[model samples]
Target chain A: MIRIGIYGLGKISRRVIQGVLSSNNACLYAVCSSSIEKANIFKKEYQAEKAYDNYERMLEDRNLDLVYICTPNYLHTKHIQIALSYRKHVVCEKPMCVSTKELNDCFDYAKRQNCFLMEAHKTVFTPLNQKLFEMISNEEFGEIKSIDAQYATRLTEQISDWHFSRPGSGCMFDIGVYPICYANRMAKSSIFRVSRFQDEALIEYENGCVAHIATSWDVDMENTAHIYGTKGSVSCKNFWKNTEAAVNGSKITVVQESDFTGEIEHACTCIENGMIESPVMSRKASLEILKVIGV
Target chain B: MIRIGIYGLGKISRRVIQGVLSSNNACLYAVCSSSIEKANIFKKEYQAEKAYDNYERMLEDRNLDLVYICTPNYLHTKHIQIALSYRKHVVCEKPMCVSTKELNDCFDYAKRQNCFLMEAHKTVFTPLNQKLFEMISNEEFGEIKSIDAQYATRLTEQISDWHFSRPGSGCMFDIGVYPICYANRMAKSSIFRVSRFQDEALIEYENGCVAHIATSWDVDMENTAHIYGTKGSVSCKNFWKNTEAAVNGSKITVVQESDFTGEIEHACTCIENGMIESPVMSRKASLEILKVIGV
Candidate 1:
């Protein structure tokens, strides 16, 4: 099994722990937090082998085969470099880095260390979306002509202040990536033209597909992703991590324990094959996301 | 009662006939077509007061106070001029003219002749949308933040060749106007920024509202319109002429005989008040739709 250590103990770490627990090819080796008490509690609660107060301390464990970085958005490059210094494969969360230069630097460093690294875009690795991408490639709906996807919520509860003061903050970075990554993946073509207003964008692909993507935290939305093609269309609500979708109005579903498990499974499989980068969410894929954000 | 003459006895005129017949303030006084047989059949079928093969002959009726022009899109300016020369008010179909200059010329000429002229945008006059707009203005949903509207259909049958070759034709003019006009009427602010690709557009209103509107004849879609705000949201299927809608999940409906009658009623009211232009679908409103189309 590919032993994994999580480098953050924040809210999203719980889902990552669930994913690691459910992954057949991996095990939860360690979890680190600035607060040792939270780390120990998480380790005990999730049956992890180790817990460390400092990230460097966790990376010191020779048994830790991989590091899943869920640190604050700004700390990704530093945390990634530190993790790779110990020769650990790393899977960083989305918005992997705010700028193209920073993201390329991380991948180039990982290459020198001969360590596997990928951005964790759970939306693309979700079982439902994987199947949808394959279907589009197979032309089940014919050439994709249009795409519409959105993610929005009213934010009933207060969020971390980091969401406001951090670089690449606000809804565009926090929520807009859902629709952006989803559309970019499904369009399957390089962007020919793009225009943006607010957090919404109209992207025309080189192969003639047109996509409109939007996201907001100020109000609620349907949160559905729609793809229209020459022959038919597909749509799913909460597409960022959906396990069910409709293909031409027919329901298609897959059993899913933790929505985050697919990414973990894919990452573990890549490490098992001695791959230095993911074929799916590769360095190039991460850069493309940033390009659409105009980084 | 406003005495009405329909200049084109084509496919859409049937709906115009139904609207006029059901209207409380207008009557179908005349029907004209290039083929006298077709004109006579429509006149007999709708019980009109006059039938003429020639356009100018029909517009000469002394009692005809209004002319509803549903000719080919390219012929709008010439048809409107002929009817206005006979001293009759006119309601021309959408895409009243091809460019900003042509539209201005038509409106300016109508002003000189002291005749009322307006573009027929039945979407804004639909009972369901009027109520939705009222709720928005009343802050029933609180300050609107986003609007999304789309109309798309798979062309199961062949359409006219003009759809491919007419100036300012294609899906954007034939169908995109529905979503464009709907969003513009609901935004209630001048555009701060706009972007377009294919037939989809992202518009940022000066009041900080954002809208994404799209339409196509290439594929089938949900054909729904959604408007979101601080408090809640509203949505309706077939929003261009819908008689019912859902406001934050509560269904709201209104009585209706014909969808086209709403525009007719509004235009007749303006005429009765001795107004030479529609305060609703005014010269500025038609110009706004064209502007979004990048005229």
Candidate 2:
């Protein structure tokens, strides 16, 4: 089993824990939290082997094969460095660092430590996104035209407590990365510059293709990504799930296509066979992703 | 007296000639057309004293104050140069010249002529857009945030023959420029770069703000500009009307705030006052606008 110790007792951490336990090749070995109260509560609740109130103490356990750094924007670099120093493979969240410079440093350190590192950009790794990319490459959609992707959530009431804090806690880093990363992959180009309004940035590429990204921690949206091509168009109602396509003259309504089958077992097999060689969350792609997030 | 000659007997020329002749300070003194038959017809229709079958013959009419160029895209630079050769001022429409290099040539001749010249981006002088600018400047909506503006018209069935031709004509120049211009004014920055997908390009600034522009000449849209700010948001349902704003939490929507009552009239007055020192459409702005036209 690939034993894992998860850090950061947030909602995402909880979700990851559940997904890990549910996966056949993964097992949750321990949990760590900054808050002692939350750590003890989670240790009792999840019935894990141990709970450490401090990340350093949690890293002392030699039995853990890997560590998942699911912390906030600022602590990612520091946490990853410590986890790698302890000779553990690491997977961190998106917008891996504040700047490309910091990301470069992390990449250098990871090479020196000889530890596996991934940014956990799960959207690109999903079965739905793969199918969409495959169809696009096969010229199934004629020629690519434009893409509009938005992921907005009402975080004002529920998430303002930690989201608007100091040291880069904002919508762009948290949720904006979703659309930015998706648009970059769809267009297959690095965004050179970004035009920003209140919270929306229209990212532009060297080739003159533009991606309209709308992300708000204070609004409500279903996280949609719509692709408009020459012959037809395909849209993901939420993230990359349930994609629907239509051509220029079709009288189609704005309904989500219901037939996209999830390739859960296929992705698991890819992982087990070590066939997923192209890391969906590469350091170069993450650097480009962070440039928009830096805004 | 500002004596003006109009080229091209197209629909835009029809309205512009009428507007210019109706103005007391400007007179539509001459008409030019590639076809002598059309020139004679236009001369009789508009009651213009002079008719020129050739563009050079009209340029020889040295008494003309300005030449309003309404020819096809490829002919703009050629006509502007001919007009400027005889020291006549020029007013060309949007997408001033087919390409940025061509636009630069137009600027060079305008400088050589030492006369007034501009692209006719009249939407900026519209009452609605003017009020939108003032409201944002006064911080009436608190801090400015994001603006989403779209201009789309269905063209599949209605596209004119010339619209699909190779030399010029597309959505980016036709209706796309309006949103881009408005967004530029509202955001008050030059676009860093643009992304081109098929026939569309989305523009963004370095600040992380975005502008969504679509022009299909083949699709129908609401044709509106939505401006979102911190205190409240304002929107204009139609480009030709004034926008309305509400203080973030308030129920009252104020339409046509007191400051800008008659914007087009003010533009004319500015012209009369030599406050029109620069043409209504500055050469620099028009050149940048042409860059996104992707010609």
Candidate 3:
């Protein structure tokens, strides 16, 4: 089994811990949290081998073959670099870092350390989305002409949170990345231009396909993605965490829910095969998304 | 009863004829078509009083007090001018004309002729949308923040039609006007800037309420509009011809289907009251929408 160390015990990290425990090829080895009490409780509840209040201490654990970075937006690059220095494969969450330069640095450091690095964009790994990719490749819906994707939430009470703040937060980094990733993967063409305002963006691909993506904390919107092609179209409601899809008005059965398990399973398989990155969630794709987001 | 003459016996003209026939305050008086056979057939089928192959000859009928200009996009201004010259009230289709100059000219002529002129944008008159407007005015959803509206249709076989042509044709003029009108009336704030690409646009209002409107003939999309406010949101599926709406997730029942009847009824009421413009589908509203469309 690939022994896993989880950095951060935030809400998302808890899901990562559950995913690690559920995976057959991975085991929950350690957890790092700023609060020792929270770390101890999490370790005890999840049956993790060890809990560290300090991130550096957990990174030094030689038994941990991989580390899942689920820290805040700004701290991702630092944690990934530290984990790579210890020669551990890394799976970091979305908005992997705040900038393209930081992302390139992380990839370079991972290459030098000969360790695997992948952004934990779970949506792309889900069976539903995989089927979508396959359909696009096989021209099931003909050539894609346009895409409309959005994720909006009424976080009225959380306006003061980092998500709406100036630095390290905004709807673009928080939720807009989902559609940006969708556009990048599905467009299958190089993005030639982008026009954005506040948290909304319109991307134009080289092949003339255009994608409109929007995210907002001011109101609630249907968290959906609509992909339009020449012959037919595919729509996935609650696309980020979808368990089903519809193609040409026909429901597409999705066997598994989009959870962290898929990414964890894929991460373990890639690490075991001595691969440095995930085929589904590649560093190049992440870079392209960040470039569009200008971060 | 108000005698109505329809200029153009095209597909939409048939709907206008049906609307006029169904209204208690209106009667189908005359029809103008390039094909005399089609015009006579339509008049007989709809029980109209007269039919003319020449548009100017039909406009000369003294009994026809109102002229519904349902001609092609490029012919709207000329027809509206001719109807105004005959001192007849006019209800033209969406995109009243191809340019702001033409719109201003038509409005000027209507004022000088002492006649009413209204665009047949049926969505604004629907009971479902009226409730939404009332809710916004009452601050039921707090201050408005954003709006997303799209109308896309797949015309794969008709790619060579006028909808895909250059002058006075494109998705923006054909369908993007729906969202533009939605934003114009619902925003109640002046749009200060717009960034657009191909068939998509992002309009930013003075109060920071950004509206994203996209339409295309290249693909099929959810012909829906989503309005976002600070407290809650409202989404109307099939928004342009919406029969239902949901406010904060509870369905708002729509009483009347969004057909030409709503606008026709309103136009007839406005004309009977000696008004120069519709309260719902106002000339100012139409001007604002056309400005955003830039044609």
Candidate 4:
């Protein structure tokens, strides 16, 4: 089994813990939190084998084969570098790094340390997305022409939330990455130019496809993604967590349960095969997404 | 009773005939077609009073108070000019003119002739759209932030269709005008800048609100319109012919039967009241929509 240690006690970390617990080839080995009491409570509640208040001390555990960094966006680079220095495989959350320089540094360090590092954007690992990738590869929907993706939230009242006030917590990094990643996948080429007005963006790819991405904190939008092709089109509601897709107005089931387990399982499978990067979500793709976000 | 004359014997004119026939105070007085056989057949089928192969001859009918110009896009300016010279009220279809110069000239001539000239954009006159306009006027959803609208058709095999081969029949002027009109209504301001790639456009209004409009002949799209505001949002599916709207996830029936009658009725009411333009779809609004499309 791949022994996993998580480094946060936030809401997203809880979902990651659940995913690890549900995976057949992974086990929750340890958890680190700022508060010992909270760490102990989380370890007991989630059936983790060990709990530590200090992150550095937890990294000293030789038995832990992997570390899932669920810290804040600004702390991702620091936490990921520490995990890689410990010679442990790393799974960092989305917006892996705020800047392209930091992303490049992390990849270089991971390669030098001979440790695997993957950004945990679970949306792409969902069964629906996998099938979409398959369809695009096989040209089931013909050549892709354009993509429209949106992720907006109606959180105007949540003024005190870090998502609104934090330095690196704008919609571009938090939610805009989803559409950018999907657009990158569908365009299958580098984005040559981009024009943005507030939280809305129009991205032009080198392959003649354009992507319209909108993310907002002021309004509640239909969190959906649409892929338009020459022959037909596909659409899904809540595409980031979608389990079913509609192709040419006909519904089809893509997965049984749309959860985070598929991404976790993918990480474990890559580690088992002694690969440093997942074939589906590679390091180069992750870097490209960050470059687009940072732009 | 209001007497209506129609120009063009095309698919859209058939719908216009149906709308006029269904109205309580309107009668189909005359029709003009390039082909005399088609004009006579249309007049006979729709029970019109007269048919003329020459458009100029049809405009000479003193009994016809208004003319519905449903000819090809290239012929709109010419037909409207002729009708205005004859001192007849006009209801031209969407994309009232292809260029700003033509739009300005038509409006100026209509004003000089003391005749009403309204663009028959049925979407904005629907009951649902009226309520949305009222809500926006009252700031029920707070300040508008952005609007996303799309209308795409999958007609890859119909290469010979005018929508693909005609000079002014690209997606921008065809289906793209719908979203442009909707965005213009919601923005309530002039669009200062626009960036376009193929059929997709991003329009930035002077009031800091941006509109993302996508129209395509290459693929199928959701055909939906979403308006995002500071406090909440509104969405309508098949917005061009929508009868229902959702405000913050609560569905409301806005119209009993969605048809072209609302616009036709509005035109009749304006002409009855001796007004020179429709209050709902004014001459200025029509010109602005055409300007955006021309861009």
Q: How well does each candidate superpose onto the true structure, as a TM-score?
A: 0.98, 0.68, 0.90, 0.89
**Per-residue lDDT tens digits of candidate 3, residues B1-295?**
8899888877778777777877768898998889999988988999889989997788778788999888778778888998899899999887788777888899899999999998888777666777788999999988888888888887745443555564567778877888888777788787788777778778888878888888887788888788888888898877766777888888877666326666778888888999998876776787778767765
Docking class of 4: medium
Residue-level lDDT tens digits of model 3 in A1-295: 9999888887788778777777779999998899999989988999999999998888888898999898888789988999998888999988888888999999999999999999888777777887898999999999898888888887745343655554458878887888888877888877888877777888888888888888887777787898999889999997877878889999987777326777789989999999998877888888878878876
Candidate closer to the true structure by DockQ (higher is better), 1 or 3: 1
Off by over 4 Å in 4: A156-161, A186-189, A230-232, A248-251, A254-258, A291-294, B24-26, B156-161, B228-233, B246-251, B254-258, B272-275, B291-294
Top-down DockQ ranking? 1, 4, 3, 2
Q: Which order, best to worst by lDDT?
A: 1, 4, 3, 2
lDDT by residue (tens digit), candidate 2, A61-176? 98886787778878888988898788777777666677777778877787787766667666665556766777777766655545677777654456644567855578887778
The candidates' interface RMSDs, in order, read 0.9, 5.1, 1.3, 1.2
Q: Candidates 2 and 4: which is better by DockQ? A: 4
| Local distance difference test, candidate 3 | 0.83
For each candidate, what is chain B's TM-score? Answer: 0.98, 0.82, 0.94, 0.93
Fraction of native contacts in model 1? 0.87
Error of 4 at A14 (Å): 1.3
Candidate closer to the true structure by TM-score (higher is better), 1 or 2 = 1
**How well does candidate 4 score on lDDT at residue A20?**
89
- Model 4 chain B: ten consecutive residues of lowest lDDT: B155-164
| TM-score of chain A by itself in each prediction | 0.98, 0.81, 0.95, 0.94
TM-score of 1: 0.98
Identify the leading candidate in terms of lDDT: 1
Error of 3 at B78 (Å): 2.3
